[model samples]
Target chain A: MNKRNKLLIRKTLISIVMVLIVIVSLFPIYWMLLTSVQPRHELMNYPPNFYTRHPTLEFWKFTFKESILEFFNSLVIAFFATIAAIICGATSGYAFARYKVGGDTLPFWILSLKFFPPVVAIVPYFLMMRTLRLIDTCTAVIITHMIITVPFAVWMIKGFIQEVPRELEEAAMIDGCSQLNVIRIITLPIIAPGLVVTALFCFIWSWNDFMFALILTRNKAMTIPVAIAGMREAHGLMWGEVSATAALGTIPIIIMAIILQKYLVRGLSLGSIK
Target chain B: MTVKKRALMLVLPTVVVLALIVIFPLVFSLSVSVRAYDIRIPEHPFIGFGNWISLLKNPDFYSAVLVTGTMILAELFFELLLGLCVALLLLQLPRSRKIFQPILLIPMMVMPVVVGYMGRLVFEVRSGPINYFLNMLGLESLCWHASPDLALITILILRIWRWTPFVMAVLLAGLLSLPMEPYQSAQVDGANIWQIFIHITIPMLKPIITLVVIMRSLEILQTFDIMYVLTMGGPGAKTMTLSLYAYITGFRYWDIGQASAAAWLIMIPLSIMVTLFVKMMEKGEKIEQAK
Candidate 1:
């Protein structure tokens, strides 16, 4: 075959492979949507309904009316946690990046906290929260989520901050600016994209985190994941309700991923910088 | 003096919060692991190594260890292979790659608890798609979650699906950063694509791959969300991992001492991995500097 024909064949083959991957990747989610709308009887049919025989919004209505409250709770926790992490991580990242913090070891120490299995802190955290009467509250979840997000934010924002020249901050300092003022005026605008990326990451991670939410919250403060898990009871599986809840829980993150793919990918990869 | 004090003041709040939130809890957990304490039974005395000793003799603990070990290895193996393939394809795609990239990340961004729920739905014995499709294809409908043999494998599939995107994204970044000259030179020397990948790309990508491996392993060892959401370590502790065991012991049994010891056990492997990863990164940096 001619080189051009071979290249065409290769491209066509790759496209076919890509389509197959996309289908396989999306099959479960497609099935999720399909099953969610299918009538309960059809949902449990022996052969299983590939196409919904009688599509209905009954499950969606159930999810929205009852089960989705936990999703809103998750949103609140993730939002507050993201904000707190950004504040903590950004300033600290700036401090490390702009100032020579005596030794390199301190920054490494801060970054290394990210690797500590979140489970390691749960036992005492449970005790500590219990002692403080903070268990089963959004405060406890946010605080625990911060442990995961802050290290990430610090690492990501530090990279962005370091990329901005020291001379800019020096110039701001020469203008009789305080360190805080310099950061606000000279550094913030330059690292705004990075800060946004860091905050979005913190949001996604906090929103997706299950262990902390599952273990920490109860009743009124429960996040969506926990609430979804709670849908299962001793009597029998509530497949329709469970699928609806899971779909509701995942939609927001899926939307965010679609909207900010590049930023999320870059953040996920670069956020781990030593 | 005033400037130095101001800088210290600015840094202090973060330092303090981090210490309270991160440092204090870690130290407290370490202390709790060694003490014979339980919130339910507050009258127990301090007993160092007692919980660890008991855990050492528990067959459930050993099974959890084996299951987690096997699951992590299996998950890591598939994730690395699939992740590398996806990353390679991602690199080769033209401008249209941007369109598919976001959709590919949806799985990774979904909550693990939600992923578990979804996995359960898909793997359901009677109503699940996996079984339905199998029946359609003239095959036996497998009870993926019912048997001890298949329980861990089911969880492993869930883990691989959720995590491979993360691995792919990291490896893609590494691949993008790699110089093109090596491939050109290899091609000039009559090297095939597989040979070039084996001889040149793999060696170049080792540091990032190692980093990815360590991170994924650590997270997998402490996997609780999916296991808890899906099986709750069911089928007679078949899918029980260390974190699940710790959670069950602490929360269900209210045996804080044993739970903390189990958590510490999980941490041992992770700490060693983290140290090695850091050392590897340091060596890579030194090599870069030397170059």
Candidate 2:
């Protein structure tokens, strides 16, 4: 084959593979959505319909009824946790970035907490929450979730702060601006995008958490994941209701994931990529 | 405040909170691991090394270890291999990438619990789409999470699906950031695509590869949400991972001592791994800064 023909063939092949990747990537979610809308009879068919003939909003209504309260609980907990984490993480992250506080050991120590197994902490956290009489409260779940979100926020914010040059702050200081004002007027604006990303991530992590929410909260403080997991009927899973809830839960995250796609690799790798 | 005090003020709240949350738990778990503690029991006595001994002897513990080992190895291998291939493909299609990349990341964005439920629905023996497709391909239906033999594999499939996107995104970013001169030189020297990739791409991408491996392994170690929703580590404990085992022990059985012991067992290696990786990352950063 001529070189042009070969190049054309390779491009076609790449396109085909990309199409397949998109399909495989999306098919499960499509199935979840398909299952959610199909009426009970249609779902029970041996060969499932690729496209639903008669769709129903029954399951969506059921899901909302079952999980709306838990969704509210999740929102409150994740909101507070994200705010707390951003507060604790951004300040400390700035300190680490600018001052090299704790001489690297402290920073590494803090980052290591991100990798600490939630299982290990679950028992102690459960006991502690129980002792504090915070069991079955949003406060309990919020505090335990900080263990995950704070370290993550710290590491991410630290990386972001490092990316913003120290010269700007120094220049501001030389201009006789107070340190706090320098941070307010200079560094904060530069790292505002980074802070937003950090907050979104902390929110998602806290929102999607199941293990902590599962072990920590009883019915009153149950989060969406726990509620979705408990959508089990007598025979088997409440597949329709579960999918409806799962689909709803996932859509917002998908939107956020798309919006944050540029910073995703950096976030996922904990800034190692940058 | 002096500069040092100002820095301390900035750093102190996080440290104190972490100390109470992270450090205190470390010590608390250790003490709990040594004690013969049960949530139901009133008198909890210290039984030095007793829980650890029994945990070491327990068949379930060993089974969980086996499951966890298999998960880490299988998930990492498949995810890395598939992720690399997808990333390379995406890299080849720069124009299409902008449109396709966000679509590709949808899987990773799905919650783990939801992923588990999806696995159940998609892998359902009686009416699952997978079985229907298998039958269309002239094959018999296979029991996925329902059968003990296939439970771990089912979980692995779901996990790989969720995580391969993350690995791909990271590796793709690494690929995009790579200096182009080396590849141009290799091409000019008559090196083929395979040679250029094997020699040039792999070496440059080593740090990112390490980053994904460590990150994925740490996550796989704590594989609970999916398992809890999918198999509950069942079909006779076939899918019982260490985290699930620890959770079951602590919550379901209320054997806090044994659970704490299991937690420590998991944490020790985790801490060591994190320390090594952080040091390596720091070294890499230093080298980069110097350059």
Best by TM-score: 2
Q: Which tens-of-lDDT digit does each residue in A222-262 have in candidate 2?
A: 89888888876333667788889889888888888877888
Estimate, for each residue in B1-291, the C-alpha lDDT of model 1 and write its tens digit: 675566556556777887888888878887888888967765768797999999999999999998898988898899999999988887778676777666776778778887787787889897677887888899988988777788888888888887888888788878888999998999999999889999999999987888888878878888888888778898999999888999999889988888989988988888888777666654654564487
Model 2 chain B: lowest-lDDT 10 consecutive positions? B280-289
TM-scores of all candidate predictions against the true structure: 0.94, 0.97
Clashing residue pairs in candidate 1, if any? none
* lDDT, candidate 1, at A23: 83
Candidate 1 ranges beyond 4 A from true positions = A171-181, A270-274, B1-5, B280-291
DockQ, per-model, please? 0.63, 0.82
Q: In candidate 2, what are the lDDT values of residues B1-291, reduced to their tens digit?
A: 488789989999999998898878888989999999977676789999999999999999999999999999999999999999999999988898998888888899999999999998899899899999999999999999989888899999999999999998888888999999999999999999999999999999987888888888888988898989889999999999999999999888989999999999998778777877798778877886798
Q: At residue A259, give the lDDT of candidate 1.
A: 64
Candidate 2 lDDT at B124 equals: 87
Instruction: Encode model 1's per-residue lDDT on A78-129: one tens digit a residue.
Output: 9999998788777677677656453456666666677778778888888888
